[model samples]
Target chain A: MADRNEILGAAQGAFNADPAASMAAVAEAAGISRATLHRHFDSREALLVELGTRSLDQWAGRLDEVDAEALAASGDAPAIRAALETLVLGYVDDADGFGFALTDHVILANADLEERTQVLADREAVLFAAAQRVGVLRPDLPPRWFGHAIYGLLVSGREAVRIGDVARRDVGRLVLSSLLTGIAQPQNQDSTP
Target chain B: MADRNEILGAAQGAFNADPAASMAAVAEAAGISRATLHRHFDSREALLVELGTRSLDQWAGRLDEVDAEALAASGDAPAIRAALETLVLGYVDDADGFGFALTDHVILANADLEERTQVLADREAVLFAAAQRVGVLRPDLPPRWFGHAIYGLLVSGREAVRIGDVARRDVGRLVLSSLLTGIAQPQNQDSTP
Candidate 1:
């Protein structure tokens, strides 16, 4: 029998290819029987809830690894930006695994997932607030807007990479620069043509 | 009898509310029988194709109204920026009606819609290239990246409005400014804090 993590991986791949894939199909993809799949997860909704929980957990782990809370509390613009960079790059690197959960309607609408997402957002708000206080971020926009903007940029970056419009390796800089400076080339920052 | 446009509008609304909504449900929503709906659209796919075509047509119309081509051809930074502003603001204003068609998988996968999307992209590329020439847009990123970025921003902005995180009237400025200047407050353009 496949381990729970292995089963979840198979299910994620199955759903990534087809959003409406059934639990039986996911079990087949994992080289297991439907009964076995049910033994692991009672229903498709249960499976989705598990995936959502795992994804949020992974996100929280990343924040902890980067010491994001301490960095944000430090009230240093450069430190906050560095932590933001780590988070963005980590997400871009794991975009394939994390993308589905981040946008999945089932995951998003799940009450538990919604609460977990709010927790992640609140943590991010600390970093954004620090950046704003230190003059690294725009004060005009609400702190929550950064959360939405980062979400948008990551989704856009993933699509661009998938379409071959942008190389995967360069997504980090492209996303970070776009987030920080917008797309327009500023006169003061101008270096070359 | 509901006109074709009326049926299309109803279908758009139905699909917006429920992406997997059945044709029978759509007909009921339109206050017409299934037979009447079939007389206008042979199948759900046909209805979706028509909606996709209409959405692309609406997008093209916005570009034409803004004279995007002429503005791009002028190769003047401010004029090109003005045209880009118009396009972004127009889409933001119509985000509720147009959002579904833009992101629907069925529409995106259709060859006909793909071709129309390419035509629109090519037209927009001219504007992007011109902006790059005058240093309005970043020359480092591919012109195509802007298209993906705008799509992401609009989707994010729509969700923000739907969740009440952002006011409907504010989406235009939020998206436009984020596109033009990004979220960071540069020292060169810093105003009152």
Candidate 2:
């Protein structure tokens, strides 16, 4: 049973690296026979679903590592900045896995997956609320909008990196700056207060 | 020759509507025989390249239609706003075609095909320069960065619409608002100034 689980993990890694990786190739990489692979996963879809669930679990675990107490002590903008940096670096390091998860999530059209996403979204909302308390994030922009904006940047930044148009470091800086300062003209920057 | 061009246009429309549409399916939709389709283009890639070239031409034509006199009379921001709306609408309406072109361009690594992108980029640079002159866009944010931001928003907004998370109208509004106002809190809005 443990051996089968290990094989599945290896297969998942191979699939993440190359979506077009054939089952036979994965079996070869795992040093398992085609028969064994078939026995483990009845079909491609079944294998993908298992991989997706595992990937989501890993992402959730990373979120758990974020120290809420430490973040609270540092203040919102800085904490959010740190979190965003962690996200970009993590995604860059495990791009293939993350990309596979993103592409699969899109292809599956599984509204149910939002249950998993909600965990991340809820964490983001908490972060945004903290930023608002610190008067760093715009109080006027709804937290939901802020959360969505962050997600949008992540998706776009990933694509930019993939296309080689933007460097990874630049993406991080751009996202952080845009989220904190905005792009409005300096003259229009006056506050109501 | 004219008839062949018409058939090619029809094929482009059909393929844009459905990427998985077979050659036979495209022929039926184009009101042409399978023989005629094969006679015009030997394969899917050839047909797509022709269509992509046409799409690029159509895009250039739209930019030409951007009435320079009217733009100058209306002033920069409004003119840019009009031009951008036109471009964004065109891309949105034929996202599949543009998407196909994007993917094909990447696969073939066709420099000539990518050169077409520069035409649009040049136009964007003009708009950014105009915004700078009018003091609407922040001087600190490089024009290239501003252009890339708008491009990123367009791509992100399209995906958001695809995912059904944001309405099409709202996507446009959000892109425009984010470009014009940015995401920064009001108190920090002019802190850079």
Question: What shift in Å separates residue A84 of candidate 2 from its native position after superposition?
Answer: 5.1
Tens-digit lDDT track for model 1 on A24-129? Answer: 7999999999999999999998998898888788788888988878888887677777788888788777666766565565676687788878889888888888
Query: lDDT tens digits, residues B69-111, model 1?
Result: 8888887777777788888888776667877665566776688
lDDT of 2 by residue, A111-130 (tens): 55656666666666676666
TM-score for chain B considered on its own, for each of the candidates: 0.92, 0.67
Candidate 2 lDDT over B1-193, as tens digits, reads 3387788767766754554467898888888788888888898667777777776776676657775335634556645556656655655455434543433322224456567766666666666656655655566655556555655555555555654656766666665565556565566444221
Residue B154 of model 1, lDDT score: 82
Local distance difference test, per candidate?
0.81, 0.60
Query: Top TM-score: which candidate number?
Result: 1
True contacts kept of each: 0.61, 0.37
